[model samples]
Target: MRAPTPVSASLDDLEPGDQALVAEVSPPHELSAWTAWLTSLGFEPGEPVRLLSRARPGGDPLCVRVGGSTYALRRAEAACIRVWREVARR
Candidate 1:
């Protein structure tokens, strides 16, 4: 099987309307906080996340909807977030 390509941009770099699947947590610690938060919202690792909107001026926080719940994440933490392009939903 072929290995998946790595997503290089921070979560803050994702534009509104974009969707991606969590490929892996880069650096691991980057996702520590996010993982806990997402779990409470039913968003598990490898789930799809839709970029719902941008938050704040400098793009420090991003609004993403995952598993029917919306979440706000910081840019620094998002930098370590890795993802793959989300395929079409069946």
Candidate 2:
């Protein structure tokens, strides 16, 4: 049988204190410019990332830590980064 595909989640989908690995930084075609900026901010594949916190009310600005630096990103911007959550082994 074929192996099951791994479930991927967007960075915006993670809750505060949650950790995940960067899988991709692909913004939609309309926002192609975001790709370079996001990568320059250290949101590269295989880099470890964590969700620090989110603003109250609308939660538009999400605080995330990637590499040694932290950045604040919009919910829509965060959605561009795809991540793979680690599953705990039994």
Candidate 3:
């Protein structure tokens, strides 16, 4: 079987309306406060998520949807979460 091509990227790299799957979330330090916050909001590997919107003035806050819930995350917070782009098959 072919290995999946790496499309992993931080949330800051995402554009609005992009659908993605949670890939790997590496906190600045393992088992830290950052990890707890992310996991609580369903930022886990294999989770279906999408970038909803970006705040005005700057993309400091990003709205995302995971499962049936939505969240607003800061650029710094979202940067710690890595995700894989979900490309549609033709």
What TM-score would every model get versus the actual structure? 0.62, 0.88, 0.83
Strongest candidate by TM-score: 2
lDDT of 2: 0.93
Question: Per-model C-alpha lDDT, please?
Answer: 0.64, 0.93, 0.84
Residue 50 displacement in candidate 1 (angstroms): 1.0
Per-residue lDDT of candidate 1, residues 1-90 (tens digit): 455554545455678898887654554664476666545654456778777877668765877777767777666656556666633333
Clashing pairs in 3: none
Comparison by TM-score, 2 against 3, better one: 2
Sort the predicted structures by lDDT, highest score first.
2, 3, 1
Candidate 3 lDDT tens digits, 10-81:
877889998888887777865468887898889988998889999998987999898899999999888888
lDDT of 3 at 73: 90
Which consecutive 10 residues in model 3 have the weakest lDDT in total?
1-10
Q: How far is candidate 3 from the true structure (C-alpha RMSD, Å)?
A: 3.8
**Candidate 2: TM-score?**
0.88
| Candidate 2 residue-wise lDDT, 1-90, digit = tens | 454345589999999998999999989999999999999999999999999999998987999999999999999999999999865443
Clashing pairs in 1: none
